[model samples]
Target: MWFTAGLLMAGAVVGNAVLIGQMSGREPVLVLARDVAWGQPVSGDDVKTVDLPVEVGAFAVREVAQAGIVGQVAGRNLHAGDLLAPDDLAAQAVPGPGQWVLGLRLEPGRYPARGLAPNDPIAVHPAPDEGVSSGSGTQQSGQEFPARVVHVSPPDADGAITADVLIPESTAPAAVEAAVGGAQVSLLGPPQK
Candidate 1:
């Protein structure tokens, strides 16, 4: 009887251990850029999941495949390895009333004579028509104003590229006119401190 009782107790202990191990859930890990897709499942294998030191509350994680690591999000810099929660990705640029977002499509090795990148300050100079500025001592006949590059499309052999430009509501008309007339767009670097 003693032997049977001991055997039964050992069996119960082993069973309980196995049951507890199975009940524990896997901890959440940080998703990596390569493993993340718009609707793909996030798992340890898909991203460089790390154990965060602090709790993230009830915020849910999302995989934004189209969003890149740049600019400020809630005044925070986004990096490649950082985890993106729902709230972190909620903020977006809201164009004010009468403001416009313009997209310029350029071919490979063309457009923005001085190379363009996101967040670049630029000036638009329209090429003067023949005989328009022959004696004016000005080769180009258009105004130069400040603008910023919001996005840059990837390069392709087909010369298909796109750039997003942000312009004030008041400047839209003149900018559009200049762009249509083969304006020479020059990207200017940020002012030195």
Candidate 2:
């Protein structure tokens, strides 16, 4: 009986040690806050946790120096240990080759669509030039196209904010030339497919 009890105690000790080791080996996931900066400590319940591969351990959030958390969105601050959603990490994915990227300059100094966020579907509307007025003296029918807002830029002198528009490769060339060559290109949200 004494020998059996000793063996059981030893097994328990080994089991507890293994459990502790496994727990210690587990790495904490980095969570990013929408407005927190890289390397900043996360406060309250702002972080989400997820398992990551050992190869990506360097990107893991460590207890010390918690600012390793990075925001998935550009132009926004990210905090450490904040659980990142798909959108948070979407920026890391590279666009497909052959995809057309067009820059739409927003009107100067106006935030008419400040609420526009990246990945938002938008429609492109090209205001007909005044010189293209119809016989009735009104501008020609405005050209409208569909696009996705891949990015938004700060305001610039042209009184327009530049948006990086992604469109099909086949239509990119004409769309870009028309927009950049002073033809109005209004961007609309993605059309319901």
- TM-score, per-candidate, Cα-based: 0.51, 0.49
Badly placed stretches (over 4 Å) of model 1 are: 1-50, 55-79, 83-94, 105-115, 154-160
Q: Give the local distance difference test score of model 2.
A: 0.53
Q: Write the per-residue lDDT of candidate 2 for residues 1-193, one digit (tens) a residue.
A: 9999999999999999998876666665545434443222334345555555444555545433333433333323444544453333323332446666687765643224444555556666554565677778887634455666566676666656677766667766556654664433333443588
Global lDDT of each candidate: 0.55, 0.53
Q: Write the per-residue lDDT of candidate 1 for residues 42-127, one digit (tens) a residue.
A: 33343454444234412425223323422213212234566655544323442436666676665544465556765566776555
Candidate 2 at 170: error in angstroms? 3.4
The top-ranked prediction according to lDDT is 1
**Local error of candidate 1 at residue 118 (angstroms):** 2.9
Runs of candidate 2 exceeding 4 Å displacement: 1-27, 33-81, 85-94, 108-111, 157-159, 181-193
